[model samples]
Target: MTNTNRASIKIGGGVNGSKVEGGKIRTEKSTSSTENNVDIIIDKDVTNSAEIIGGEIHVSSDLKAEIQELLNELAKNPITRKEAVAIEVIKEHINDNPSLKQRLLSALKAGGTEALKAIFNHPVVSVSVETVKGFLEAS
Candidate 1:
């Protein structure tokens, strides 16, 4: 005597993604996997939506010059240790995206509170927003 039997199982798919909107990020993630001889099929759809949120950091030319000077001073002042670390963090993130860095530079040049606020919202620079603002606004 001999017997044969089969089993079938179904699975749903998943999706993962991130979005930045109005200086904020909305993220979602879903995943599924199967093991053994069993066949698992999962279907998922992901959508990411975002609008560049940033404005000029409004600063006078003199203030901008001072900010530049302060940036140069980062290496000299031990008191700026936190600021230095934040700068490093921002640098590493920016290095991964040249265009983003350029955009940041342009924003800085334009000078507006919005620009500064936008930079503050960036994940890499979030922690250093105040430090960055201080450097840019310090007289």
Candidate 2:
């Protein structure tokens, strides 16, 4: 039911010893393949489960101020976590190409946190952020 490789994760109706090239049966897994790869999936009948939460504004009042402060600081900084290896990759790209760094910063300023988080899971761009804000509406 879980794939620890992080290369891909799958939650099949039934568990298999190993994963193959990926056949049918509605995979609930995380795949890093940019070409039609998978990140998160649910096999339940529920449809239209995607939702978004505007940063800082989507959290509870009790934790709102703290989360906002965190967001403001992180929005203009570098990351430092082994799990966030993607950031290293991004840093490399930015080092080699400062223009890209500017471009991404510009995009972030324009799109705000929501878009940046989406880009992380998205293939075309690779940027991830913490302090996730769950959608106000149910997914």
Candidate 3:
């Protein structure tokens, strides 16, 4: 199944950061010295099908499962000699798969850190995924 979504959004300002409140999106201009909060109300007609937790939007559980399944498939071919080397192997494996990288980036953007923790928490996959997660966040 495809995971594309479309939404009609109304933005009021040049938002650098955002949060959802009362089904509306509020934005803020991120700065080092002063914080400028701008409240941008979304249209009442606009609806979201994805899950939301603690004001953060997240991908569906099915998507998370799919990500886990793909990671498991990748993990089937072992390439770890030690704990440190295992992380590198996992990073290389993820980097080698464009589709997987795209899916992971999508999940990370949609679900934030919590979603990443849930997907990569598996004992066998955690180290590698964690390493990749750091790189993803940095970039």
Candidate 4:
């Protein structure tokens, strides 16, 4: 002979639902008493990433000469479409930021090497480098 206790415990609740034996269940979500009353803290890096490149350079003279030769080469020949697109993207970025323009002017006044260094690893510079390299290898 076997005996089975046939009991079904149906625990069904939505959101913050609860069940109890002859007790109240919220069945609703509770919101914070203090809504929209909060403070947000933000820590921003004000230092320019451009400065990092200049900090790493030990021989400015050699860098300046290399930059000058690159410019001379570009000036002496017609640029490929890839190079033109890269330059356009860079120009748009510089035009959008007045502070960048001022910083660029200052760097140029100090020396072309400093100016070159400022944008050394920038997205625009990366694009330009890859585009130029691709063109050179193709020719």
State the lDDT at 132 in candidate 2.
22
Worst 10 residues of 2 by lDDT: 52-61
Candidate 3's C-alpha runs over 4 A off are 1-82, 128-130
- lDDT tens digits, residue span 1-139, model 2: 3222122334444323423232111112233211212233334332244331222111122222322333444444445223255455444544565554454454344434433343334222233454221211111
**TM agreement with the true structure for every prediction:** 0.27, 0.30, 0.44, 0.28
Best model per TM-score: 3
For 1-139, candidate 1 gives per-residue lDDT tens digits of: 2111222233354434433222211111123111112223335554444222322123233332333444545545555435567577455555565665555556555533344443343222224555544544442
Q: Candidate 2 regions off by >4 Å?
A: 1-82, 122-127, 130-139
Each model's lDDT: 0.39, 0.34, 0.49, 0.33
lDDT of 4 by residue, 1-139 (tens): 2111122223333212222221111111123111111122223332332121111112233333433344444445445224565466445555566665455444344433323332332222234534323332332
Q: Candidate 4, TM-score vs. the true structure?
A: 0.28
Report residue 4 deviation for candidate 1 (angstroms).
Answer: 69
What stretches of model 4 exceed 4 Å from their correct place? 1-81, 121-139
Among all windows of 10 consecutive residues in model 4, the one with the lowest summed lDDT is: 20-29
lDDT of 3 at 62: 54
Instruction: Show the colliding residue pairs in model 3.
Output: none
